[model samples]
Target: MSRQFAILGLGYFGSTVARELKRHQNQILGVDRDESRVDALSDMLDHAVIADLTDEKALAELSLETYDAVVIDVDGNLEASVICTLHVKELGAKEIWAKAHSDAHYKLLKRLGADRVIYPEYDAGIRVAESLNYHAMVDFIRLGERQFIVEVETTERLVDNCKSVAKLAIDRDSLFLVAIKRGEEVIQNPSNDTTLQAGDNLVLMGDLDALREIGKQI
Candidate 1:
């Protein structure tokens, strides 16, 4: 199903998001105070308009309440971002996602009823650090409270020692295998007897510490 989205900024972050969402066949309304920025994305988005998002009257004209969600990314101007968030919330937008440049900005956005607060730079830094620290871990998602779902690649030593899923000596109480990704194929909830291969990607869910331990061994 196609959903409607309103992106209230045309900077790098907001423009990138609008383009990707439009690519997914979603109806996107791209708004910006800059005429050039709005024009650049006009072809890709369902609607592109230049408006002062801080002005509640201008925002009201956009009919933001009708969209499935609204994304506010005017972090370049903190005051404008805050004002836009407040107006969007008052307009009864179903979901509001705002970008925060600092801890204080995040708190304020949350208080203003933004459904999600994004820290793009900070999050990217963490992802980079994790990839560097865990050589075998390809990627991971934090599920809060120290739990994580991590994807780690199998090593030659690991495959040679454990020929099948059940043969791997991991603590089942703390860690559980979710799936095996071999090249283009994915085996979900693989059987205990499923064969293991070097270079295969294993999807595991467990505590962060336990996942880190497996990463070290693999």
Candidate 2:
């Protein structure tokens, strides 16, 4: 179902979210202190208005409580962002999502009743670091602090080339062969006797360090 959302900042991050939401046909009200910012998004949003989000009177006029969600995406000035989030929370927004520039900012946003706080820079850094650390890994998704789902490519020269799944000596407790992708075909929970091709892509889920060890052997 399409929902209503109020985006309280129309800078890069806020505008990006607004456009993506609009693509899904959600009703969006784009708000910003700068007229130009609001104007830039006016063509796509359900409503675009220039308003001081920190001003309670200005915010009250928008009927923010009626929207399904409120997004706080202004990070240029942390104080203003905090105040805007506070006002949104106080006005009883159903769901409050805010972006934080730093750890201190994240803590403040949480204490101010923000339902969710996003630290994009920090989250992206972790993904990049994981990719760099595991040279053989093509993709990584963290399921827990020590658990992950990773994709690793296979080559003809690997130690386990042409070996059946059961011969890999993988620790089933810490590792699972979720699926194997060879070109357009996907084999899920492949049989123990199923053999791996030279160029097959392995999709695994398990302990991160254990998976890294398996990557080294295969």
User: Which 10 consecutive residues of model 2 have the lowest summed lDDT?
Assistant: 154-163
Residue 209 in candidate 2, Cα distance off native in Å: 2.6
For model 2, the stretches where C-alpha displacement exceeds 4 angstroms are 153-169, 179-202
Off by over 4 Å in 1: none
| Predicted candidate 2 versus true structure: per-residue lDDT over 1-218, tens digit per residue | 99999999988899999999999999999999999898888889999889887898899899999999999988578999999999888888999999999999999999999999989999888878876877667787889999999988876656355477877757899999999888999999999998878878889999977897887775
- lDDT string for model 1 (92-202, tens) is 899999999988888989998999999987898888898889878788899988999989889999998889998877788899999999999999999899999987999
Instruction: Choose the strongest candidate by TM-score.
Output: 1
Number of colliding residue pairs in model 2:
0
Model 2, TM vs. native: 0.83
lDDT of each candidate versus the true structure: 0.91, 0.88
Report the Cα lDDT for residue 205, model 2: 94
- Note the residue pairs that clash in candidate 2: none
